[model samples]
Target: MAAFTAADVKALREKTGAGMMDAKKALDEANGDMEAAIDALRAKGLATAQKKSSRTAAEGLIGLAVEGTRGVAVEVNSETDFVAKNDKFQDFVRKTTQVALGLGNDDVEALKGSAYPDGGTVTDKLTENVATIGENQQVRRMKTVSVGQGAVVAYMHNAVSPEAQDLGKIGVLVALEGDANADVLAALGRDIAQHAAAMFPLALNADGLDADVIERERKIAAEKAAESGKPENVQEKMVEGAVKKYAKENALLSQIFVKDGKATVEEYVARIAKEAGASIKLVDYVRFQLGEGIEKEESDFAAEVAAAVAG
Candidate 1:
């Protein structure tokens, strides 16, 4: 006996989303070592894939910038939302995004090594901000999109400051390729970027969507169809139909335009192209939602207060 208790199993379950029995088995196998138990569960693929380190237990702003046909979006995270709203933090995010635009690369590590406008490298400036602001901060990620001919439009949802609408919780960049008039292309790009921010499309089109995501959707559809007790042929058809619907809903070009709800994004682009007298194609897009896919640690204020009073 490795001296493990029931509480250990419970904690393991909570941390890994594993079944009670599985957690118990893992703990027993690890001989009461919590870390080893977690590793065992992960090795067996029985635990959630999320790494403890990757959990973005922070709040911050998504910064976006567009210069002519090029645009960049960067997510800078802080330990608290209070720091996210700080003017200095916001300025850092904005300046970092501008620097990212110049780099024209998506590598955050490389961006950190790049120079900051004031003087030192971006990493050095960030370290200075962390020391002065009294909070742990990081430049989490960056993405850039561009078009050789048309325009790259940026949109920010729930903008922190109306005066400078480049910083927000959700940032989007849409690249439109065409030879249309600059004004017309800009207007159209704005509308499309707005739509992208609202709809949160997974990819530009069905063909571009990740194969793993498509397969996962198919599996879910197959399970649902099985539950219906239908014939084998009918079940197959049902799964296919469900997958097509999923693609239409999740793919950007196939999704219905959020602004009008009357036409697909592709159709909307065609309509705009007809009006502008130039062929416009949506080349690419990037959407960054702050803290997306990162689980935050939950705190119990009441329990903390009780414990403090008891102490």
Candidate 2:
């Protein structure tokens, strides 16, 4: 019998970021000694997994899965675009998105805990994948959108290559709610989703914009207005006006639809609604632009040369 329990293996894996099987094997070899197992992993260089996990994983595909009225978008990031192109990595992302779609909501922690289609949990699989692929990967975020009565459409933008189907750097889902024709709803949602993919709307509506984002815009507007030698009252009005304009430009509903450049997104939806013969509402949406906020580390050649010389 193995001397270590599954919890011991899990702890070791968490501490060292080693894969489940390797952690268990190390624990067994160390006769259930946590410290000894960690040492063993360190000697094998697998203990560096924890450090690798901290590296920016800003290059990967956005995995998307849509089923009828519901759709899920998952962002699985890797250390390099080369890894993103790996079949195993792509397969892992695709399976992860499928698992997330089954979860019915966008809880990333729960998704990680959920069982993978393979023999182990999603986290276990991810850890093993990282070890085998020799690169750190992260299942960062997932969003699930559904409509009570309508259709949710999906669009993937800028597929890495011709072979990369149904996966892209940007994945968008648009849920349109109404009892209108499903086909019509799907068509309209696809159009909207494509627009979202191109335009990169920050939120569904002006009010949905983040407070921090709005505040940042306000600060910029105030500074610019002050530079105009404007009075306090005018500056205050200018700030509000600029903030409103920012919100309008960044929100999906108020932004001009890119397809024709004439109608606002909401207006485009209303025009489609007339064809559908019912009221249509874009109730929810999710846009997963890969690595949107992650700051990738730039390799410093001078520092590398200095460190090498020191070594």
Candidate 3:
């Protein structure tokens, strides 16, 4: 049996909506013959999955799952919202989230290369899906959160499909460090994560604040301080004080609680820790807003229609 090259596998996969491994299997079974591989896929009825892969998959689902001491979140994109509503697409999202949780890596490329259930690598499966679905789909991003003694809680906002389980467009993961029970910590975590999504804090604490961001603020503060016409030393002190205020405002632990707008986040977490009888440490968190930086291609629908008619 001849070994199939990547191009051979890709071409076979494109012809039959089957995964890369499946395509290779077919190709190998066919003795590296492309037509034979297509016939092999047709016999299996999985060829359609390959045919649909070329279509754009822009609208899909964000999936979240929590098990044991860890939680995972994943974003799988499809070409249309209709596909997102499809049970098949939803299942893909769910499975992808589970795969992401197991990998425990934040890198998208790594996750794509990670093993997928039912054979073949995730990348291979995605390629087959692209061909089968007839749309350009993507595994956009993934993240996992876990702790030694604590719980990592997750919340998905505005679930249009069965995907978004909690709130709006924001998905968050908050890690609490302590021996807290999953149920109790999860409740608190959801609230805190939701707050984080709403507030968009810059860092877990003042110490973790970005140095460049701090410097930029310092420059702005110095300019503002100079406007007061104070002495050089006094202006310097004022600028320093201003920088401190800026840090307090942007840093997560220092930000005032959004719910009550009274106590700082640190104080609030302290209160929770006391109530829970476990020391809680805010290790880190992640918040993702759909299409945050991706600039969508803008187009005029009417012009498109006119062009189609003219053609």
What alpha-carbon RMSD in Å does predicted model 2 have with respect to the real structure?
7.2
lDDT of 1 by residue, 1-311 (tens): 55699989899887765678888998888888899987777665512222222445468999999998999999998868998988788889999999999998899999999999999999878866654454667899998999999999888898997887899999988899999988888888889888888888999999989999999999999999999999999999999999999999999999999887899999999999999889899989999999897667787989989997999
lDDT of 2 by residue, 1-311 (tens): 87889999999987766788889999999999999998787666544556688888999899989887889999999998998988888989999999999999879999999999996899888877776576889999999999889888988888766766568898888999988887788788889988998888999998899999888988899899999997899989989999998999999999999997999999989988897679899888999999999999999979999997999
Residue 261 of model 1, lDDT score: 88
True-structure RMSD for candidate 3: 8.3
Candidate 1 segments whose C-alpha is farther than 4 A from its true place: 1-56, 302-311
Ordering by TM-score: 2, 1, 3
What's the C-alpha lDDT at position 14 in model 1? 71
Point out the higher-scoring one by lDDT: 1 or 3. 1
> So what's the TM-score on candidate 2?
0.82
Model 1 lowest lDDT segment of ten = 46-55
Better of 1 and 2 by TM-score: 2
**Local accuracy of candidate 3 as per-residue lDDT tens digits, 30-96:** 8887888777776565445455555444466777777776777777877666667665556666777
Model 2 lDDT at residue 129: 71
Pairs that collide in candidate 2 are: none
Model 1: lDDT of residue 287: 92
Enumerate clash totals for all models, in the order shown. 0, 0, 35
Model 1, residue 99: displacement in angstroms?
0.9
